[model samples]
Target chain A: MTLELSTLVAILAMAAATILTRVSGLFLIERVKLSGRARQALEAIPPAVLMAVVAPTALMTGMAETMACAVTALAALRLPLLAATAIGVVCVAVLRAIGL
Target chain B: MTEIIDETNTGQKPDAGGFMDGAKAILPLIAAVLPVGLVYGAVAAGKGLSVLEAALMSALVFAGGSQFVAMDIWTHPASWAGLGFAALLVNVRHVLLSASIGPKMTAFSTPKKYASMLFLADEIWAIAEMKAREARLTPAWFAGVVAPFYASWVLSSVVGAIGGALLGDPALVGLDFAFPAVFIVLIMNFWQGRRTGAVLLASAIAAIGVKSFTGGAWYIAAGALAGLAVAAFASQGEKTENGETVE
Candidate 1:
């Protein structure tokens, strides 16, 4: 596995793009005049992306995963995030273990 | 601008204990992140990336979710544009994370601020915010907590890479569950408040819908846009409510 020139360039592009995002919030808030609605939207983006990333995969993986995620969501309301995550992972691992 | 300017903590103490405090705060999260980093390294190795590529990404990008997403689509040089777009979109949250910490950070010098940005991540932000609730937060504290987390992630990537090389299959023992499991943990933190549920549903619908129709990054981007659009309305109601309303 060697790094091709295109791959290297792509790597740099990604690094640059990520660096901008890392810095964007601090600077964008200063330059960009945001409406109340826009503020709401920006605030919501992270959670939305979180859903988008996991929802599809969980739905597709199996019934056990869907159930596990639901368990995690419930755990979220009661326990710490890591604890909720542990519950979900354990749920899935157990289901998979039982060949569900 | 007024709000941001108002948040500028002028004449504050440039304290050093934050490093120690932050270092202490992130201990639990380190336990969670270490396994995920190992999984990422193994996944990268499974995908045929050299050790350097895997290590550089973990060290430079330092974002677990975006790194996982990028590696899922990783195919060397050709996948950069697609990877960049998706990863950045996934990282769009960082803009918010940095903003939340930005005011406290305004007290730092320019070079110090820039150096601290390299250590930004969800767990770091959460710990910093949690600490700010009780005491004054310093850039040093933020930087200190981030150090161990960064080391944990990068080191685990190397470890996982070695494990993948030796084991031959990263998912041979169900280690593939790390990605979604990590996301589950993260989303839990963001799951509170009224509008969060609505936004999550809309985003999930958009993501699943787009994924069923297309094969690229459309799902993630579309889901994000859909959620934001819904949020435009939902967040306003939450703000006016004047209380934390959980549904």
Candidate 2:
């Protein structure tokens, strides 16, 4: 499929923005030198950041779907990460197929 | 874990053994990241992007979550300004990730630092932190570990995107499960200790609370904000009881 110039521009811009987001943290952290308290706060950022990304999809996706995903995720936690992800995927697909 | 970092030598040669160890350390992370890469591939292709553009994105941009967000927003009827704004908002979290790793990466050369920053995802950061602590490796070793993982991610993304273009049903091959499964494993790692358990519970609750009020992308920002607030309060309380600041 051929993409429009506008779409390509948007994609590239988005890519640039995303890279900037990841790189910016490393850049600023090295230069700025955060203190003890500030470092603690930084440490806390991941869970919050991840929740910011994961919570919405989990909650908004409906109970069965979310629960299916969550259960599979929980199960995956016990296994290797790859295996766990695979389990979650199969769980979701199978449950969806069975009309759960 | 803390002892490992404290006891190990900070400077070590990057031997064949070290590279292999790095590769093994990153394998699970790669698996976790691959599914998300596939999703990005499928969406990018489905949205009518050419293979070259998608590959370029994987090579140059390399941020998985934000790339997915950008691809989604690209299809929206919003003006370019709106799309840019949305991408920025979705990616603002990276600022936090960068901050978390910044202090630890200070000793590297400019190019090494820049090159290493490319692979600093959640999993990579977590693994690097653990390895750094355990091995007491210098910044160079840290780079050696992260650089290969970064290359692998870009390669997988390109392959996924190309595969998405060729295959009629990429989902049938089970690429869609990567992100959620990876996330689960990551979260499980966090949930191990009591302190981490509290953090996870609080973060999950905060995320759900924010997601209820705001729709779409706002949930991420709100959840993160809520989590920060909660963590700050908890940290301060710990300080008060201990009569000493946490380092």
Candidate 3:
């Protein structure tokens, strides 16, 4: 595919926006002092925010995909994180191969 | 007491142990990011992006999810305005993340802040939060943790892009599974105490809710919002029981 200048620019801009989000947190967190309640809320944010992000992707894929991911997540809980991920990817491939 | 004093003094050089501590703390995070980096590489190549272009994207922008979203938009030939709008929606969460980390970074110089910001990711932020709790805010320790994480992301992206070009259909070999697999691992890492069960329940509900109401993109957003709302409510209840008001 021929590269369009516009596509290139858009991709770069998107990348910048993404980085800004990640860095903006560190930058701002240092400049401002958060109160205790704010701290508690901030602490709670990650799991909640991440669950929101990951849940839809895992479930919407389909029943088999969701189950497969659950198995992987369960395995991740028990085993080393990296190993569980490898196992999950393998499971996905094997299932897809068998027409799941 | 002397050991604690020595540790607290930034002027004293940290021995090899401190470096290793930093490395150990960041390793799992690096592992979590690797697969995503590979997927980014494969997707960019599959979309016919050049090596320099893809690598630069990872290096400069460095946001994994947004990069993937951008790539999806790239393939569709949408208007620049549409692409920008979509990108903004996806990244608005960063404003919150930045706010959480802001106060912890006061000691860093302006240049260091600007440069280090480029390496920020969800995993890195989690790791940095822990580090900040242990040490007084200093640019050196921040760099010690973030530098490796940033390098891993950029390097893996390059590797993934190259691998993507070579592998062709990533799904054939199951490389596409890498993305989700990485998240499963990360979610497990963040799952602790009651938060684990709560997150799982909320996610399951949100997933179903979003899937029924909208397709994938909106599904993700709705699901995330649902999870956040549920967590916020739960946290508020806990605070009330403890005789504190929720902020």
lDDT per residue (tens digit) for residues B1-247 in model 3: 2223434565567544555666778888787778778888888888777767778777767677666766665654534555555565566566676675655666655566666666667676677778888775456566667778888888988898888867778876667767667666767776656744565577567656766776434544554555555555655544555434444
Q: Please, what are the lDDT tens digits per residue for candidate 1 over residues B176-219?
A: 66678667767767766657878888998999999998986778
DockQ of 1: 0.60
What does each candidate score in C-alpha RMSD?
A: 4.0, 5.5, 4.8
Over the stretch B100-184, how does candidate 2's per-residue lDDT look in tens digits? 6655654555565566666666677778778766554445456556767677767766666677767666445435545645555
Model 1 chain A, poorest ten-residue lDDT window? A1-10
DockQ, per model, reads: 0.60, 0.52, 0.51
Could you give me the TM-score of model 1 versus the true structure?
0.88
Winning model by TM-score: 1
Candidate 1 docks at the CAPRI level of: medium
- Candidate 3: tens digits of C-alpha lDDT, residues A11-58: 666666676666677666667887554555455455555555556557
For candidate 3, the per-residue lDDT at A9 reads: 76
lDDT of each: 0.76, 0.63, 0.67
